[model samples]
Target: MEKTASVSGAQTIHKAISLLKFIARFSGEGARLIDLVRGMEIGQPTAHRLLQALVAEGLVKQDTSHRYHLGSLVFELSLTSGHHFNLADICTPVLKKLADETGDTSFLFLRSGDDAICLAREQGPYHIQTPVVPVGSRQPLGVSAGGLAILSALSEQEAAAVLKAITPRLVMFGNLTTDRVWEYYLKSNAVGYAAISNRAAPGVKGVGVPIIGEIGTPIAAVTLATTISRMTEERIQEIIPALNEAAEQIDVLLRQF
Candidate 1:
């Protein structure tokens, strides 16, 4: 009986942790109970019990609208663990300047496992803005300009491993196979930047440069997003220098860690 009880406790802990991570993926957007049930493939009663236990521990919270989100405990632990530093604080000013200069949206993306998560975004002084990945959104590595930049900055072997992992998720994003991602990486390496036209969204284009960190590893990338009509070859040439310069500045700032 004792051994059986211990096994059950361990399973419950695993389920709760998985649920917490799923909620974190949406950032603060929260997840409905039905969505969680379907996503975790657990019965509604089991999910509810696990969520209640997590909420009691302050690791998760349920809002008035009955949606679940990561609680303050998760953020407090992240700070203490030093897993994610003040990334937004460090990159927002640089992104703002880049956006102002280019008159387009600028984004900062950090590598999180096999995915790139948007950390910050700055909108420029343009009326016809291009819709882009929102803050806290995650994209498979090599799918977006920032993600492709990070992938290209990796060593050949490491990049191949990442491609293998994310290939299964590419179909959901349309036309983004491993072969296409490899092609993008090659183009990004040739120009010292990643440029994608109409990849993430229709009529929306982006260019990005990787921010290399300790021992020449890519910790993140900065990308500029604009409309397809504004992303001509001449414009890409003109903005490459600015993008490169911003990436360098951000790299220097992050190394101060």
Candidate 2:
């Protein structure tokens, strides 16, 4: 009976975590309970029970609109886990400096498995904003400038494997087929940064440089996003220096820890 109970507990924990990830994909817009049940392919009653348990643990919260969103506990745990060598803290200053220097939104994305997670963001002085991907959101590598930069830094064999794994998720991004991803990879390798114009978002362009570690491994990328009108050839040339400088600074800092 005790062994059976332990197995059941493990299964419940797995289900709860899966549910949390599904809810996190929605980010600011909490997911509806019905949608959660359907997405998880679980009965309404079982989903409700699992959710209630999560709510009790403060890992999930139901909004007034009956939608569930990730709770404060999730953020708190993330903070605690990375407190020793925090990527956000290390990249925040670099992001701010980039935004100030270029007057374009700056972002830091860290490679997490085959996905890239937005670890920090700094808004520029421009009145118009490009809300392509929010902080804390996860996007498949090669789908965004930052991700593509990191992807390009990988070895040929490693990059090919990652692209194959994430191909199914690339359909949502315009012109992000496997061949197109390789094109971006080659461009990034040639220019020392990844440049994408009107790819992730129309009228928005970006340039990204990989943050190389002490051992010459890329662990993250620094990117600048701006309006297409502002991304002229001259402007892109100017931004590359700033992006590369910032990435170098971040790399140095990362090596310290």
Candidate 3:
């Protein structure tokens, strides 16, 4: 009887996890109790009990209509897990110094869900500028050089999912096919840096180097954006070494954090 009871408890935990995954995948349209019960193929009473447990743990919340949605617990867990580091605190001063030295805009970005969130930025002395991706604004993971750098850091399965999520928006970029994206990822991995010219924005070009973590994963990216006219082959060659050196310094700082 004891062994049977333990098995049942494990099964119950698995069911609850499945329910949470279902709710998270469709967070925009919250799932009702009936919807969850039906989707998870569990009895109403079991579903209700599991949901109550999840709600008590702050992982799920009920709306006025009694539909279930993901709660703040997931966000809290993500922060605690160190998947989302506080880049602004570590990168702000570095970015300011880079901008001052390079006379080109510097940006720090990290992967957040299906978007790359700008965490810090510094403007350059040059009046010519690309549109600033504001701090905390989300950019599609498929288009921006910063986004591609982050995507390239993800494991294959995770990167594929991110690409699928951002596919619809790829239309804005003339011919960005999935094969091209995968090719870019492979190239970026090999070269240790990513670059795009006239793709993210017209007349704007950028290069990015990944800030690798202790475990060799890409934790964030440091990018430099400038007018295409200023990004001549010779100029790109000159900046690549500086960008690489700065990326190493930032990576060291991040690991300390």
Candidate 4:
């Protein structure tokens, strides 16, 4: 009986660490308890207990919505470990070069389940500009170019699941029917890239290409976003080659890690 209890205690500690790691990955915006439970596939009581322990350790905190965010302990540990890899590390230089070369905002994004999470962004020199997609902002996979690029790389089943998850929110954007969304993904898959114009955020036009890993699976995406007025078909053609080259570079870098 005592041995079983000891084993259970150790398992609890491990689960607490897993929960902390999950929260750390999303850091600033945090996560809702229900989402965590569903994503982690853990029982509610177990998840709650682990989260409470993490809170006591200052590893997580509950916000107004009762969502959990990383606490000061994570910040302190980041200072010592230097382990946090921000999107800026991999993308700032690439975005700067793209912006300088194309005079358009450059962005980097990654698939986070049903959403595309913006990891990095750099603004262009132009006066008329697209609004910045803040780091950690999440967009549904069928709408934004960055999201579609990631979706295009997913397996059919995975892509379908993501689309189903975000179906309710689709109506708010471009009158996108499910059939149209599926067709878009198919076309994007065929072309190996995706583009969108003023779908969610008005006046912005975006083109995105996936960054594939060593195993030929997508790990991230690179996007070029510009004001609608500046995004002619000729301009998109000019940017595609550069975006593809940049995606390759990022893929190589990600493989190193």
Pairs of residues at least 3 apart in sequence or in different chains that clash in candidate 1: none
> By TM-score, who's the top model here?
1
Each prediction's TM-score versus the true structure? 0.67, 0.66, 0.63, 0.66
**Residue pairs with backbone atoms closer than 3 Å in model 4 (clashes):** none
Go through the candidates in order and give each one's C-alpha lDDT.
0.81, 0.81, 0.75, 0.76
TM-score of 3: 0.63
| Model 3 deviation from the true structure expressed as Cα RMSD, one decimal place | 12.0
Per-residue error for 232 in candidate 1, Å, reads 0.9
lDDT comparison, 1 vs 3, better candidate: 1
The superposed Cα distance between candidate 4 and the true structure at residue 244, in angstroms, equals: 0.6
lDDT of 3 by residue, 1-257 (tens): 99999999999889988999999766556888888878878899999999999987767767556778885455445654754446466767888787778889988876556776777788878777665566776777756778878777766776787788788877777667777787887877677677776667777888887776543445578888998888776787777787777788887776566
Quickly count the clashes in candidate 2. Answer: 0
Alpha-carbon deviation at 211 in model 1, angstroms: 0.5
The positional error of residue 242 in candidate 1, measured at the CA in angstroms, is 0.9
Each model's backbone clash number: 0, 0, 0, 0
In the range 209-247, model 1's lDDT, one tens digit per residue, is: 998754345668999999888888899999989998998
- Better-scoring candidate (TM-score), 1 or 3: 1
lDDT of 2 by residue, 1-257 (tens): 99999999999989989999999888767789889988999999989999998987757877667888876456445544856237677778888988988888998887776777787889988787676778888888887789989899887776898899899988888746899898888878777888787666778888899986433446789999988888888988988889889988887776564
